[model samples]
Target: MAITAPIATINDHSVRILAWNQIGSWLTYTDANGNSAIKYQFWDGGTDANSGFIWNDAGSGQLAANTTLEINAADLSQVWVRGGAAGGSETMWVRAFDGSDWGSWDSFTLTTIPNSRPVATISDHMVKFDQWTRVSNWLSYSDGDGEAATRYQFWDGGTATTSGYIWNDGGSGQLAANTTLEVAASEINNIWIRGGSAAGSETMWVRAFDGHDWGNWDSFTLTSQPNLAPVATIGDQSMHVGGWARASNWLSYSDPDGDAATQYQFWDGGSAGTSAYIWSDVAGGPQAAGTAITVAANDVSKIWIHGGSATGTDTMYVRAYDGQAWSAWDSFIVTSQNTSPVATIEDHSVHVNQWVRASNWLSSSDPDGDAITQYQFWDGGTAADSGFIWNDAGSGQQAASTAVTVAASDVSKIWLHGGAATGAETMYVRAFDGYTWSAWDSFNFTTVTNTAPVANIADHALHVNEWARVSNWLSSADAEGDTITRYQLWDGGTAGNSGYVWSDVGTGQQPASTVLEVAASDVPQIWFRGGSATGTETMYVRAFDGIDWSSWDSFTLTTTA
Candidate 1:
């Protein structure tokens, strides 16, 4: 193991030196341009002066092309350039001369201007707010000596820090000339500026220590201009109110700053821009204008608006907000709408012979405060077959035929003629909305409990071999105008009356009568044949009204055989 001392040469001149390590041998000198040039030379084994090593192939006299230099040769190296340009610095490399061998060349820089600091210029001083963009060619530099690179420190609220480049430097604020910078959307709201040499006219300061001398520490304000306000536009619209007319209608919009709409407002019905029509924010229900809408730069914003409930020649105004500001109101007009009238009919039940009439019947209502022009009534049932006729038939109020005209909001007395039948009857009616008829509504009326026909027969006397003959022998009268459907004749005591048992069939008695009508003269001949029994006989007769039978009427008759 042998330890060898190193030797070096520069400008082809040998300067007296001592114990130099082969790995590290450096020197510094001022060039004609006043720029500091540093060179490094190395050797594997050598001694001062009489050592066995010389720089650059010995007789070549200068450093080789591939020779290298170390800017910071110390094991721990910290470097900062200064004074090259206002707000700017530069780095350079030179050939290193070595005895019989050329070392690799490296670069270093000067950070000192005799009496001036670097100046900076930003390309975009005023940015449109609520938008994100890159500041290309944003910060430029101009130094009195020369320009190398610019290091920037950004501040949002106040002055930049004097300690280190902080804020949004994109990790490292030390950047080359004409480099682009990016600003976030959230950061461009109020204040933003770059601090460095050559950034702007604002006086920025820097400190550069060249081993012994320290540079000036002065603060320079970077160039800063307030951002412009975002631009927005809302489109006009027109439509009707309520029902199908008020659905899916929207107003168009746009914003230049690519802002999202956070609020929407509109007027109900009034002159545009007058504020006479109350302005209301659209949140939900009929007034909700939708949510989370965005527009691109110089592009249209397709924002939708719900017209809500409005009618007549309504003048409406609309505006949109992009979280920062509200756009001007856009105007539109809406036409009036017509509403349909509603029709209704009530249900009822009554005894037979009580006819359904106009007094208690159908009714109608109009929604648009308009009059129900007319009411049309219809009756359909089996009652029509059996002499059932509406009293309004002659007045053109017949079922399925006529419309009752009215000058008011409601029309009543629409019904069917409840016939003598023992059952239900149905009628339908509808109201006209001036333009069209409403949906038909139906009602049911029942006719029940018909009065049975009365059976009257006078007493009679006859011989066993003879039959009695009398005109108007049995007569029926019904209160409900019901005709006798059948006659029942029984020859016995009254049934369930006074302990007189009356049976449909008995000894020496004729069969009961099934005839709806019997000739007035021979009613007894049909019930008894030649007076078959020889004793006082009792006979009972009753009438049916198609629905039910009347109470039996008894007549006593003396008979001889």
Candidate 2:
């Protein structure tokens, strides 16, 4: 990028901006004005400054991690600038921000998810992991010395997810304690471990072993919780947990007095604690256990509880959001009691109740207490489900709280709605790329929302030929109370030059004119009107071989029939 003039001022600067999704690099600048750009730059850095501007590397500073500079505005006016080159793969992402916080938090990972078939490789005594593709997964030298008799295991629901993944010492080799046999992902979903080499008792160090970094990798005891089928996904620098979190401080306490929790409380925010905000209820009712909630794309969180009370009468709530605010009593359900109330999240149709992953339909549930008895998937709104299933069957019921593996093709536009009865209903749609379920659609209503839902539509195909009679038709609609009309223009095909006035090209429409086509040597145009000519009639500029439509840009058609 070539910089003009000796001084690039806020008033003068032009550039061809280069942008790549989230991150962009601009050959931007700074103004040596009343404010020391650096001091002033850093000054606004923490204040009201925008992160999008840093892409310019404005003599102000270097690009920070997890953020984009805000240069599109005059805030950085004195610092004249424009688009430049493209950044790296880690361009588009989120950085943490607070009205009063650091130069900006190290961007937040909106979706913490599980990668499909996470892979693992036994390395340096640790288990290294890898997701579907990018990002390595590995358990560094923690428990072991990175050597010897290491038995790697890739499991699901507690058994070897794949044949080759479950490797045991078989009392053959001797893996040392803390030898840290890190593992990397293989052709499996993911790799975790219960290895104490000498003790033989399984020690849990549960974290996605991405070949690169382990995000808040958690460790658990295999004895208390014997089985877990979790999913982890690595996006940009964002790592997520998709599987059910088997542990919860909330469930750890049980009142011997049976008085129930004097108060039910939960605080959600960064890392579940940092910058956390609290929510509590004074023994108003039973408290649900576990912090491990189902976090769908866009931060939608859900969980199933089997021990709120004995009777299965209370509502089964699934919490959700778009980008802001959380909903109370979002999901509902009805079921009996069973311990293994599996709550799973899958993209490809996973086995639920007892069905494979198909774009048509899939589901999740709590095996007992709040088992899934009904299924409803929304493509942004109730109107979007293809039939009733996400991929096929649109309506049904079951007895489990497991992920409904929607046919991969039916993702993105669909949503997850769970409820036991009807009063307290919880449901929200998420954004997907037909592969991974990223975040939930944040757009939701405050009360019993009846906002018009967005319809997922395939754009209609429009075509024309030399002997053109643009017979165009589109299947779209306005709100239940509104009308949407369709129109087209060849502009006489001067590429995009002519404007022979558009007219009524259809009948039974607001403008009652069924005049649709014109000959090769003729040109016709049409439009609609409400209170004129014939109450609601189609105005036209009839058969113009080469003539002005009319003084008013409209004319009567010379009827061929």
Candidate 3:
């Protein structure tokens, strides 16, 4: 084998290859603001040393004909771009030499992310974070190579990290994903960690803290943008707190009080420059002027009483101003009551599933409240008469439909506003278990409060051979003083192995405890919790074998939305 040494050099635009081979290269100058006024030449390899060459080529304002540079007998074999212009460190792939027939163009090479570091500890290695994306909830990413991580850490941006990146090892503790976490939900108050999941994606859970003991980490999961955190806070005149809003949610507050109203505010996470809103003088006028609103980790935006006038029930509209544009009226009339409403505007969320369980109000209240009159949902204009009527409509408040998990998808088009308008305040949250109704859970909020409605169904998932984990936070409360929020899971099987089991990992906080999951075990099927105790949360899942249990591994993936 023979190794050849490379060579190259140039004095002017033309390199004196041997002697007669000296080819003078000149750049063709153009006028209309072109970037090609420079002197580098894209010679086509053939050049004539003839005296009139330069004058002849300049006449056409471009290469007179296919101008080709000639290579002397021993000219450097490698053809390349002659260097000129700014510093020499420009990106190589994007700046190729311009040839007679070829123009310089951008190369297709993608920008490179640093490769994942290798690992020296643990069974499987995990790297890269899938936080707050618009696709899969908490879909993690890491180099699948056996190398151990150089460092490991979880950050929510709420707490600043000196370095945005985490170095593996002694910086953070180590734990198995099985005995570790399940799934996670990013929220405002109770941001859950130790989020986990299992096979069949059925089992799910999260660990949460209210600045107190870790409560049973609830079970939950998102269909989109899992890490998308809560963005707003809601409250009434008495207690101005405990409100929940997702990425693009729009909670409506109607002002029935003939006059306008006022409000309080605070929130986080959004592009402020693009997320601001404007008020219009006319009904449905364009957003005139307003500061750019961003939903950062801690920044806040609120629509207070701009002062409304006019006598008697003049219905002031409370619409949501998404960064892109204003959604339809979020709420209708506020009347005399002062309220800071709350609602979650989901993504591509078309039809809401309202399973009619034993629905109805107990015999009492208004003169017409004998046995609970009728049920009708709304789509802004008028209430839809087409709703499933319950045969055994029980005596309780009907469900008002608020989000269980805020933005599983995106906040773009799905501003959840439509709902039941004329039914009793409370309703049952029922789910169809492929057969009968899985029992109804009651929910209610006062007119003086800004409590948004609750989602009527639990996140149900299935994993073969393992228990169908159902993260049911569908607890309820009745206006009659009986509030029941305990959710039950059941499988129509001969044995009890198919029913829902109540197990918790994270302490349930308002927002943090919003994440959950059903995970797969080492033995084809298993269930356990994932996430963290502190704010640095992760997704993990564990499985239980009849004889023993396998360890938990943090979920590492990059799924397409």
Candidate 4:
């Protein structure tokens, strides 16, 4: 008989034997005349004919005529057969007799198969942290002779092994089929996971037994999963030529996987164009892509930078690392240099009637190295609305408050004449680049008054018989070289009182010339004559300039006989 065919089957309340009936009837029959007949006998021994079989005759109470029997193929011991199969191989023998005829011996064979090994699979092919996960059994099988059981092991980087890692009872580290395993990941870990399985094999060389013999161990590998990268955020930033940005005040970095940012990178000046921009560590220098920074988790830092001798708006960028990978770049701005000009002045003092130049007094420069495009001047004070002079016609020129057009650079050495007034005068100036203006500068100076001239004359007397000359003793001078334009001559009395008529010539007086005569016009000298009963005559003289007159000088004369 074939091994797949059943030698015996038990169903309902009866057992049916197919192969046995083919060999012979193992049954007893009864006829209407109350006589009993035997067809076959039951057996429990090796294959050897009716001697190896046990017999139960009809009407002898040994056989129940058609008694029911049960058998179990899964458990060969319950088959009620003799001996047992080795390696799922076994043989049996039986024989039956009909009344007076005997049948040849019949035989039956039995075979049983063993169970197969189990396979393991995880619910998530890429297992990650921060969530509960299960390692379920998938496509696992068992042979007809056994059942399957499974266990798991884990490793950080590479494949897992039984001896390499200790197996827990389906807990945190160890895992089993349909069981859960959770691993918490933080910034401190490098985060790469590999899962291992020990299917049907918990201990060394030991397999799971399912009411039968043990099975072999089988394992599988799961895909590796890594942690997430960090995120970097940049805040608004601004800096002057000599200033720096404080990282703590302007940047934020974090990770979604509960990890801390391990490093920071920076790029300064212009655009952060692709890979052309070199990245630098937060602590120092330009570093490679994977280089570590000196900053700690959630810590603050500073980025020092200069204007680099350049001006105008500039840009900067930054990024962070979570020990495993780098985050996307974040951008900000770094303004460099300036355009406003600075102004300075030098004070001066001038004597009255002197001239002062304005151009040589003030100077200015731009911080950004820009050209000094424009300049303005204040006459008396530095008030914004004060007297300001500006160029109105040329490039970068402007009109002053007085609406007067000034030529570019016409302000150079502009002369200022000091008047008679003696006091301090102020002049303020400011400069501008093309974009911005500078603070006002101030200059102060003083003007002094001029001295006046003086005249002198000596007293002289002339008798009626004697003539006197006064030109040698009369003179006038001025400290400022002012010319003596006029001279006046008069007596203590009016012309009627002296009764002497004097001839006037050469505008009444000339240096080193004789005085005019009273009666005659031919001589240049003046001669005093005695009047009727005159004792003495007095005369006064003075000099006059365009703006002032000298002090009067007087002369006395007596009549002589």
Residue 205 of model 1 has an lDDT of 34
By the lDDT metric, which is better: model 2 or model 3? 2
Per-structure clash totals for the candidates: 36, 125, 110, 3
TM-score of every prediction relative to native: 0.31, 0.15, 0.14, 0.29
Q: State the lDDT of candidate 4 residue by residue for 1-561, as single tens digits.
A: 211211222211111111112112322233333323244333332332211122222222222222322211122222232112222333444333334443344445533232333432223243232222322222233444233343322322232352112233324443333332332211112212323333211211112333323345444434434567788887655444444445555678788766677777666545422222232244465433333334554444544334323345655667888766788888776555455788777876544555545566667767767667666665663333322233323433223322222333665634544545567667666776655567777777555554445656565444444434445456668766756566555555333324232433444422222332231122234323334444666655666554455666666655444
Q: Model 3: residues >4 Å from true position, as ranges? A: 1-302, 314-332, 336-561
Worst 10 residues of 2 by lDDT: 234-243
**1-561 per-residue lDDT for model 2 (tens digits):** 332221221211222223222221222233323222221121112111222223343464544533345442334433422123321111222221111222222221111122222222333222112111111234433322122212333222222222112222333232233343434334222322332222112333334433223434344333221111222211111111111221122123232222222222232222222111112222332233344234343211222122222222222223323222233422222222223322223332111111223223333333233323332233222332111222334634322222444443444334333221122222233323211343432222112112221212122212121122223211222233222122222221111212123334333222133334443222233332122112111233222212111111222221111
Task: Tell me the spans in candidate 1 whose CA falls farther than 4 Å from its real position.
Answer: 1-126, 129-249, 262-265, 269-311, 321-328, 335-338, 342-353, 356-561
Give me the overall lDDT of model 2. Answer: 0.27
- lDDT tens string, model 1, 219-319? 43344332323333333444323333321234465676566666655555543331212212232233212222333322222223332343445555556
RMSD to the hidden true structure, all candidates: 17.9, 41.7, 42.8, 27.2
lDDT of every model, 2 decimals: 0.43, 0.27, 0.25, 0.43
- What TM-score does candidate 3 reach? 0.14
| Best candidate according to TM-score | 1
Q: Write the per-residue lDDT of candidate 3 for residues 486-522, one digit (tens) a residue.
A: 2222222222222223344332211322323323221
Question: Stretches of candidate 2 above 4 Å error?
Answer: 1-404, 407-409, 412-426, 429-485, 488-561
